[model samples]
Target: MKKLSVFFALLFLAFVSLPAHAGEIPIGIYGTLTGTDTDVNGMSYGPKDYLTYVNERAGGVMGHKYVPILLDGKNSIPEEVKVFKRLVEVEKVVLVNGWSTGGTKALRDQINTLIKIPFQAQSLSSDVLDPQKYPFIFLLGPTYEDQVLIALNYAKQKGAKTFAFIHADIEYGRAPVRNALEQKIPEKLGLKVLADIEYAGGSPDLTPQLLRVKELNPDYVYIQDSAGNTVKILRDAAKVGVPAGKFFGNNYNFQHIIPGTLGKDAEGFKALQINADWGENIPMMKEIEEFGRKQKIEKKDAYYTKGWVQGKVIHELISRVLKKTGGKIPEIGQFRIMLKDEWVKLENFDTGGGTPALFYKDHQGHTQARIVEVKAGKFATISDWIKTR
Candidate 1:
């Protein structure tokens, strides 16, 4: 009888000590954590590192600790849709973040049609801003069109009289390709676009295409490639002495290619990244660099940058959400609206400076990119601060 009584008391104590909301205040975060899939950018670490940043200081979102729900989209269109639906129906998480371009587009209609929960996407495509189309989706960066325009403007300043374009055949590559092919952008910028080319996935050698471009001698080359093949393309171009002096690419490659395998040949490569590598010579970089050192996150690894940016955005969103609804479980719809509405404060727009804004309504952030140059051996920044875009 005494033993039974003790067990009952222990059981009651356990019940009382349990967290009030063990399973509540659920927020879903999914990305390409581990897999052959690479198009998502370094988004694989964005949420995890951001959450680590949050938990390191403050307890959790709204004092209710969060449990990150990780899912591997496998960089597939259909698989992403399936996983997203499972995240909604099976898990019933309140909010979500981190779906790449293909995955984000896949969920566009389904999210609008059935699930009303607001989803935060790491991708910065223009398509997400259409409220009627993707009512529940919010993009994390500027539109693809704006990023391309920024690259275009840079090409003009570099005196690119004509352009040669190449891209890995994928939905992610389609935007920049179409933007280059369809638009009279070069004419407006007082330049000419000479050659536009497409190659099959995993083409192994871009030599034929690079050879053709060399023959054409376009002053600039515009390209987007799968993450795996980006290094090879740059290597091939360097060997052939392609006439692409001013090479421009969208965000897909900037975070993925540089500071690594692309090697010394990729030094002069210039890309318009939505986010700059505050990885060097910046206050945030300094702070995170110290933290990274402690965490053994190599400065060369782009995850540190992606994590830092994700932390910044998450910090802003949490602050805004708290101010609006302190302790209560916020209305999911209203919370989604707030998530989309809040913007992170950025130091310089783009790579260096002179741009005044960080974000605007048309699915774009004004952040400039570091004008990285390949000097001596590897990628070096000719101008740490590029003011144009």
Candidate 2:
């Protein structure tokens, strides 16, 4: 009788010790964590770390923590599709963050129609912003087209007459450059484009291209490439004596890691970025700093902060649902429904001041970017927020 009573008591205690929520809110994120274009580590890590901080510090979103299953796409589109399936069908995740232009564009139809899971991605392709076509896929920032417009507008203001365009021979590299050269500049902005050049990513020598750029001497050079490839371009341009001040970069190339890699060669380099720099003491960044210290993270950058903002948006939606339902976390379907019906209407949504206020009705979320210049081994915001759309 005493053994039976003790067993009952222990069972009751175990039941009480279990967490109040049924299970974690599973979210999926896939990015190019490794491979040649591995700058996404900071981008992917930021959101993961913010979710970790939420669970550890804020008691999670309504006491149900975000359980993220992250995978590395290795910058491959096919691999990314497989990872997406694994996250959705196999893992049954309700929300996801994707990477790469090819992967995001490839999965847009399925994610919107068949899967019906809410997705936000790192790719800034303008095609994905159509609400009628891709209702489930949200872009984390302005589109590549918008970035191009903003960069060109800035160039025009700075007395740039003609432009030299350089990009990798890939979809991501081609998309914005194509839009700018073929449509935006000639028709809309009335700017002159001198030379359009395509090079393979991570090319060892860009002397031929830099030599061409030097000959043209366009008022500015707009480069659409990753950090690794950007290093090659800038170094080769310096060697070829292309004026450093005449060079500008897209958002992916505006990373802090680039300046560190280029040292003195990176001086006067300008690039467009979607968010504030690392050391900016925004409200959310203060919290992130504390979280970083606890986790032994010595540095944080713009990409990391961008990821953190993505996680924050997901958390905010879940939080609203939980609040409305009296601490009851909604099911996956309900969560999707809530986002589609109500959550997206959120106006002036705070993305930690990393980017502009996100107004989701237009489906592009604050089509604004800041220009940053590398000065004294760090990136500094040189211009006020400029709307691109």
Top candidate when judged by lDDT against the true structure: 2
Q: What is the TM-score of each candidate against the true structure?
A: 0.78, 0.91
CA lDDT, every prediction?
Answer: 0.60, 0.80
Model 2, runs deviating above 4 Å:
1-21, 296-299, 329-331
Model 1 spans with C-alpha error above 4 angstroms? 1-24, 34-41, 131-135, 243-246, 255-262, 276-283, 286-300, 331-363, 383-389
lDDT of candidate 2 over 1-389, digit per residue (tens):
99999999999999887556646888888888778678645777777777888889977776577798888888888999999999988887878888888788899888888878888878888867788888887876778888777878888888777887898887888887886666656446667888888887767898898999999888888888878888888899889888567888888887877789888888988988887667787887887888977895523677888888888887776777777777776777777767664546767888767777777776666788888999998888898887765
**True-structure lDDT of candidate 1:** 0.60
lDDT of 1 by residue, 1-389 (tens): 99999999999999877544333445576666555445444565555555665655567765556555667777667777877887778877666765667778777776666666667776666656675566566554555666666667777777677776677666666665575457767678887778777776567787887788778888777766544665656777888985224576655665534536655667667655445453556555565555565565423444436545654555556556666664555666666556656532323333222122445343344444544444444554454434433
